[model samples]
Target chain A: MSTNKIDPTKWVDKYSDYLFNYTIVRVNDREIANDLISETFLAGLKSMKNFKGEASERTWLISILKRKIIDHYRRINSKKGQAEVRIKYSDDSNEGDWLEEQAPDRLDMTAEDIMENEELGLAIIRCMENLPEKQAKIFKMKTIEGFDTEAICNEFNITPSNLWVIIHRARTTLAQCLEKNWF
Target chain B: MSKFKSIFVDCSKAGNCCDKAQYNEASLPEKVKMLVHLALCKPCRKYSNKNTKLTKLIKDCDLKTCTEEEKQAWKEKIKQEIALKDRG
Candidate 1:
């Protein structure tokens, strides 16, 4: 677990692509994603001793990246909040996004195909963005990433009932978003 | 029947496709306790069905894996950096 020894042999084989994609997905910016991925690796290596294999290697790395993303947004919102009043997600007038009808056409697309289709992926991502931070993250990790409820509860430090409420609310919110925006 | 009775009657134990586990996973008897409510609660029934649909949609949209080159690059970059950080 020691990051001290630059075992290029062991390192490069393990986590390059997954890290990159993770950063790309979260940051939605390639260069920033690249930097964040690097930062995640470095942090992981330094704290390698802390890697108890508790959540697997990849989750740990993304956890770091997630922090970075939050930091990025905090800075953005702070500045943007004052300069350009942010639109409240709750305001009901379609927020000028021109949401499409619910797409009842849930046919002919494979899971992999849906994931690859930027339009479909972005559609789901947009719905997620409308959720509260905690609910959105939990839903993404548990439902989208196939993480178990126990893992979600442990990671978020939420009660079982609370977890269910958050997840249920997230599902309901997402359902509404899809129906309103993409169908 | 009565409204409160209807509320109880309509309720279901979660996880039964009919009851839909995501809504609640209480036992059959527990669900029966809410049977009247379930029978009347359109929202819960729709919710259960929506949960089922969402679950399927999520499962069907699992992300695709990255290419080998992307994998190689990430590994190289992350490991080198880890080596540097550990040294500090």
Candidate 2:
């Protein structure tokens, strides 16, 4: 286990882009992503003595950045109540179901088609940004990272019901947003 | 109770069913209720189908990354901060 300190000077030029790209995708906020990068470097510097060269510098930095992202979400989740207000349906008769008039037209595109449509991709990101911060983070963890329900509940210190409610709210908002913007 | 009573659900319940199905968290009764609702309500069915597709789209979409200029600026900022800390 080599104990040489990672030179702080070379970090910016070598790994900044990789780390920035990684964080921007997960957080979808450039300012926040940049902040995480700064935090990662500072944390890394403090723990440089513990670096054993087991993972490449990039991997180590990414691991730190990942923790920072999780911490960011955890901090946000702790402050907010678990039971978010339910979204109101257009019509009271149907309880909380979407009104027929507001129901989105069926999307006909395939996964391949969506992948190629840069406009649609941007639209999706915009919709995600519109979601409440905690919902957006939870949605990303579940869908993008494919974290299981138990893992997510454990991480957020939320119950299964709370997790499901958040997921439902997030999906409904995303579907409605995409339908309005993309379809 | 009749099987009809057990299986029947309103549109709102159907919406919950759709969301639960996305996560594979719906119970057997909820699943049955959703299926019945979808069969009868075209709009709810469309909602369920689209909701599922949206999850798939996000899972599949290749997200955009930071630009080179942005990356460079971030790196510069980090370097400046670390240098200041060292000076202090």
Candidate 3:
């Protein structure tokens, strides 16, 4: 009888970044990605009654987002064979030479590598959620956003020394959380 | 004794410096003091190594966040929809 509850109110704060990163890498267009996420949220709300609460809210939302992404591709694909043009290897001239061009580019990531990095990103976000709210915010602003120490201090109304202490604590906690699986 | 005290830092200061160094924010003198402490302290060295690895992993993940304006728009949509459902 126990099930995870869903809270629409907290969705933006809790999972928006995770979902955004997941989406942008796939869609590769900021505007399209934003639209897809909006649609996903709307769809999730409309289907709220069907949710059994068996899965976590995030997992459920992600399932809906995946559907939206697929639908987007399907829509574009159905429009005048636009998808066909994206297949560069389909051209007849490169018949024998295509395989050579398929060799992995040194600068690009393999699909598996990209997948692992995505998983790692999600893991870090989950660990960050475990931190106190202020600490998590400060850590993200400093480490992820690359804000200057003085700038952050002025925003948070804290001194440089206080900011460093917070950063030190946040880093230590994050390291411990990731030690077993990632470190 | 006073000169030695000025040159050497304790573990806590070393940890702070290590964290700052992860962000490339530590001054050269601060880094030198941290290294001196790390040389003599086993646990601190371990902490430093783990901290460095943590920084690298985070950088490699390349996580991105939604802008506040976009997040606000989503939140507004969700709120309006919720209000409509409640009324209906």
DockQ in order = 0.20, 0.16, 0.82
Residue B21 alpha-carbon offset, candidate 1, angstroms? 2.3
What tens-digit string does per-residue lDDT give for candidate 1 at B4-33? 444344232332333225433455665565
For each candidate, what TM-score against the reference? 0.42, 0.49, 0.89
lDDT (CA) for every model shown? 0.60, 0.75, 0.90
Off by over 4 Å in 1: A1-118, A181-183, B1-37, B64-88
Structure candidate 2, residue pairs in collision: none
Q: Report the TM-score for the A-chain of model 2.
A: 0.46
**Higher-scoring candidate on lDDT, 2 or 3:** 3
Query: Between prediction 1 and prediction 3, which has the larger TM-score?
Result: 3
Off by over 4 Å in 2: A1-119, B27-29, B62-88
Clashing pairs in 3: none
Displacement of the residue B72 alpha carbon in candidate 2, Å: 18
Tens-digit lDDT string for candidate 3 (B1-88): 9987887999999999999999998999999999999999999999999999999899988988777799999999999999999999
Show model 3 residue runs off by greater than 4 Å.
A80-105
> What is the interface RMSD, in angstroms, for predicted model 2?
7.8
Candidate 2: TM-score?
0.49
The complex in candidate 2 yields a DockQ of 0.16
Residue A49 displacement (Å), model 2: 37
